[model samples]
Target: MLLTAIAPMTAEAAGEPFDDEAFLFEPKWDGGRLLLHKQGERCEIYTRSGRIVTEKLPELREALADLPVRSVLLDGEGIVLRGGRPVFDDWAYRLRISQAAKIRTARQTHPVVFAAFDVLCTDRPHLEEPLTQRKARLGELLQRGGGILTPTVSVEAQGRRLYELTAAQELEGIVAKRKTSLYIPGRRSSDWIKIKHPRLIDTVILGCRSEPFELVVGLQFRTVKNKPVGRVSKGLTVEDRDRFLQAARELRVRQEGGVQWIEPRLCCRISYRDRSEMHQLEDTEFLAFLWDKQPEECVWPYT
Candidate 1:
């Protein structure tokens, strides 16, 4: 069976980090989630969504192919590091390149490191094995640091401390996994929890774009002025898109330059990294529609 057919286990989001002896904490790498399957001398990489990306990352293929094992299935994150921190934008750009010439150039300029965290198979399947056992096997199979393939470092029970360190390092966040949990394919289990450091803001819907579908959001300033912050589309579900569009049609005020202007009555909370000089939200993702929030309540500075 193709490894891509096996969906990687996902983590539930946690609001805050806590000290837990039952859980092992590791850095939540800020890049694409990938699964590598190596059989004999052939290796393939797949995205979380199961798209085969082996061709896009030839260097990773070569590295995995060189592994001493006969066959292994590994779950990891593909990241491009700069100044000791993962640079997601560079990794994202690397995923988009298709031309052979450009890909060769990118391999030299922005090489990606695969941070293996979980082992699904090594000579045989290990899905029923506990996470600790799987990790132990993984460590024995692979080298620890400074390589194209590296192990994801984890602390036994210092979830809070790891979270703090990641925040200080400007890293993505931390993941806490139950030490005895078994890998369940395609499931979002509570055994693993992800704690991210993202600032949340509630913004009123100002307008929307049809093609590809993005929400133009803003904040109310001085009780009357509307300040456009940014456009968001990521994390919107099919239901969310349908519901928002249905409500938007009723609130349609005007259309300008392909944007469907709507009355700023609907509000939603979004997670963002920071704001630009123009005050536009950066790295913004839609969280949820705020049915209880009023447009006036989403004021500037987002207090």
Candidate 2:
């Protein structure tokens, strides 16, 4: 319903970080990925799938309304910065809250900021232009210290160093992309790579999901206290999926959305933002399939 569903450029996963003068690095913010659309006085924010979340995030909507342009589409993230960190759980809770009074209270307590990174359009399309040109234009359109919309910080030819810094701060990760790359919607282009933190943790693959396609992963963490952490659908190559499916039939546990639940016997290492809260891990990635270690060995601080 808005701006022809602006598709943000997607990034491929890289095994490790590297340095190249051709590529620029940006700190990957841990929050909801949003494509904010604003036209005249009407503003709407949508997820990658194009679901309208304008009503859900009133503060972001207000910020967009304050933009200097009459019509624009921006690719960025919506984060609730708490103690200098993006607390995603709080953003998720705010998205579902129904009471007006509660929503107002949360807005005052934890305000949302739109971290604009790319400009898809400003009354006209900029998709044909290279990323470097687009980024400069975006900076001109969005003023610093002027609204909730702050442009994401970028570094040149220092992806590895930036990755190390992000890991040190326990931030999500860093994304590197070619300056000459054009915005290719709905495609994971090689020009862009998402390099995850170096930290790794072992978890068990409990099942296979097929509807939207996911790997049901779990861990016996002390914080979660011996429970299934959550599902991990990204970071598995085609070869990994093929091999996993080969041994899946025999380990079936149950079914939901074509998800072949299996016995928790498979263990693997993965990279993610951080630990689980209450009962699940967020933004998970499958790194490898463990063969030498037992599944119980994948327990939290498991030995």
Candidate 3:
């Protein structure tokens, strides 16, 4: 199946802009991107890459076990509450379980809830419709629903104001989507625009690698001598991981099934919070390097 034929917009790409009067702005949640398809008792949960992750979110599976609709597709984020707020870390804990025991532990330690935003299909297919209509239908479906729906403001000025408010609240950021745009399967048109939290960091892509399981990007910081140091692997979008793998394959540089080497490009931005003393490395005596950035870039907007 063609990638574009399935879903149009991703976190990295924003769609086109609509008329000022017809756009809707929504708060971007600081959680894992998610898509849920349900057919009565059975459910299929997908990541942005179309990877099935239903087993990881058993709590959500149980929550939607007996929905009225026989089949439905919805897009949103899976959020886990932390300190009266929904933090991305909580969601990450729920999504990255590898061991059976770890899965059970995650369930008990950090229960999660699905914060649905868009309904792709409902009895009748609705993805191709304008976002305005889809949102209306979604509102009806969630009239008294338990999950949190992303709050939206149709006015651009109000959208910006809300963005500031959310930012002050320490939330991630806001997504401004054109309300009148059709849901094009895979195009990253200008209809959907994402105004991120301004949490930008420059890092170097010192090296690339293919993990034993998931494809990952390896990165490190540039040392004083201008050499890459502190190599760390993992943490990347499936799209990015796949591209990294493809590049490695073309280079034909697989060493005992480890990561491929890539010269630091000094490109890429990341969002991160300062690590606390509890997270400080034991090898370092002082809590050095308040910010962690890949050697490629050294801009830390979130700090």
| Candidate 3 structure quality by residue, lDDT tens digits, 219-260 | 332223223322333345566556554544544434443645
Q: For each candidate, what is the lDDT?
A: 0.86, 0.79, 0.56
Which is the winner by lDDT between candidate 2 and candidate 3? 2
Better of 2 and 3 by TM-score: 2
> Residue-wise lDDT of candidate 2 within 1-303, one digit each (tens)?
245676667898876889999999999886778998888878888887777877878888887887777898889888877788777666666776768888889888868887788888887888889989999998888874266888899999999999989878767789998999988778889999988675578888888777556787777655553366777878888788888888676888788666687887777888665454343676678888886678777775421
TM-score of 1: 0.72
Which has the higher lDDT value, candidate number 1 or candidate number 3? 1
**Rank order by lDDT, top first?**
1, 2, 3
Clashes (N, CA, C under 3 Å) per candidate: 0, 1, 19
Per-candidate TM-scores read 0.72, 0.72, 0.61
Candidate with best lDDT? 1
Off by over 4 Å in 3: 1-5, 11-19, 148-157, 200-303
Which scores greater on lDDT, model 1 or model 2? 1
